[model samples]
Each structure stands twice: as structure tokens, then as C-alpha cells.
Target: MTDSQSNLIDRYQQYRTRRFLANESQTSSWLPGWRTQKRRRILVGALLAIFVAMLAVGVTCHFGVEWAPLLWLPVCLVFMPVWVALRVASGRQDDAPEAVLDEFEIDQRNGARSIGFAVMQSLGLIAAFYLIFGAVITNGDNGDMVYAGGIFTLMAVLIGGCTPAMILAWTRPDPDVDDLS
Candidate 1:
């Protein structure tokens, strides 16, 4: 290559390296501020709280069709994975490289996030369908169980999965080059 071309290549490479390193250094030590934490916490709580309230209603009223509170239970299932993710992925941030999750943990979290996204997308579609055609029902005995059980389950799983996945995506540090592409 010509000297100017070679110089240009070198500069680009250096720039890339410097930029990558800068990202690593900055993100590695990044700790969420109180305000950010408060916001995320509120978001998560609000998202999950609706499901919990529904659950309380279902239990309190014995999942009655008249109350139709039982329908809320299935919708609340997404809370499970989100809660797990929060527990597993919490406390991950520091200057030390070892402070971050290893490849396996990172991969697992990414996989979970992907699943969460898919579940959430599916929930959106389901909601749209329900809005257009009314809640899913069939010859399944008075339509209450189908509405409360099937639709509720979908809602729960979506909320539960999406909440934690969002929290992780927002709060977790950028992965090291070796751990994630």
C-alpha cells in the first residue's frame, strides 16, 4: 500500500482501538445513579404490581368468573423470569474485569432477554387480536376460563419476562469484547 494509504489505515485502526477502549473503561465502571435507579425501580414495580394486584384479587375472590379476577393470574406469569434475572444479574459493575459476568452468564442473560422480547411481542399481537375480535373464547365452558386463564397467562408471562429484561438491558454494563460480540 502507498504510505498515505498506510498512514490512513493506521490512524483508523488506532481510532477504533482508542474508541473501543474508551467504551470499555467508561461502561465498566458505570454505576447507575440514584435517580436512574429510582426510575427503573418504579417502572419495574409498576409493571409487576398490576399483575400482583390481580393475583391478590384472584386469590381473595376464589378465582370466580363473576369477579373474573382469575383471568389476571395467567397474565402475571412473566414476573417469574424477571424476578430471577434481577436476582442473578444484580451487583454486576466495577473497575475490576472479574466483577463482570463471565461468558456463560452473559450468554444466559442474553438468551433470556431474547426470549423476553419474543414473549412481549407475542403479547402485543395477542392484545391487538383481543381488541379487534374480543377476548379468546371457544366451547371451553362459559368463556370465562378461556378469558381468565389463557389470556391472563399470556399477559403475565409477557410482563414478568419483559420487566427484568428491560431492567437488565438498562442497568447492566456493556459486555467485554471477549464475552459478547
Candidate 2:
């Protein structure tokens, strides 16, 4: 409330941010915004290609696949976006903590949390089913099982990582004035 108290708090916050950023591994090779943009475009294109291939292989075969290309593409496409977004992001997340956060940020955070929880719950159920039925379904061969598990793992990571950005992008606040240019 008082000037000196606020000043001390601000100093501590600055130190905290600096400390976190310094220790962050991503900072070591963090790309500029333009570079990140290029990477995002490329990644998205790769993902689209993967989706088409997966579709060609049939949706049912998307998971539990033994083909290395099928297995690796989804894994890379899913994980890379998460890593890139976290490391090279420029959003409210990178902004200083505010005494009063924006409603949009708060909503996005909540949405992300909900999405993450749902995905975890779904994954847990699937894991439980596979564990309980492992003998009956795959006796000695779990090649497909492992393949499916890998795909699901990637999906889980992708959903958990991108939920915040997806929500924020989906429900962004309007500009000061809505105008068509």
C-alpha cells in the first residue's frame, strides 16, 4: 500500500523474474520472434502432412502403429510445438505478475487447467484398462500396445502444453475498438 513497501515488492519481483529467466534452459538457445514464427509455420505444415498420412492409414490405425515414420512424426509434431511455445512465447505469461490480473488471462488459465485435468483423467482410465487387460489382449506381444501408448503420451503432452495458448487464442479480449480495416 505504502510507497516504500511497493518499491520493495517490485524489487523482489524483478529479482525473481531475472533469476528464473537466467536459470531457464530455453534462454540458452531462445530464438527471436521472427525465427519462432518461421518455425511455427514449418511445424504446422509438418503436422498437417502427418495428419493426412495418419488419415490415409485410417484413424483407427493412427495409434498402436509400428511404423517408425508414423510413430516419430506424431511424437515430434506434438512435442515440438509444446517446447517451442513454452520457450519462445510472447504473451501475458511473459508479462510481470499484476496485482489484478486481466479477466482474459484468468479465464485462459482456468480453461487450460480444466483441459489438462480432463486429458490426464482420460489417459489414466486408458492406462488402467490396458494394465488390467494386458494379459487378455496382448499376452506376449505389446508392439501395438506400446505404439498406442506412445501416441497417447504425445497427445497428452500436446494437449497439456497447448491448452493455455489455444484457450487464450480462442477467447481473446476484443481490441479497444472493433473496426474492419
Best by TM-score: 2
Worst lDDT window (10 residues) for model 1?
Answer: 90-99
Evaluated against the true structure, the overall lDDT of model 1 is 0.50
Model 2 gets an lDDT of: 0.50
**For candidate 2, lDDT tens digit of each residue in 78-168?**
6566445543432334232433347766665676667766876776566556544763777846655555554555455555555454444
Give candidate 1's error at residue 172 in angstroms. 3.3
* lDDT for each residue of candidate 1 in 42-116, tens digit (9 for 90 to 100): 545755675666555434433344755544545446555444333323332211132245776666566656666
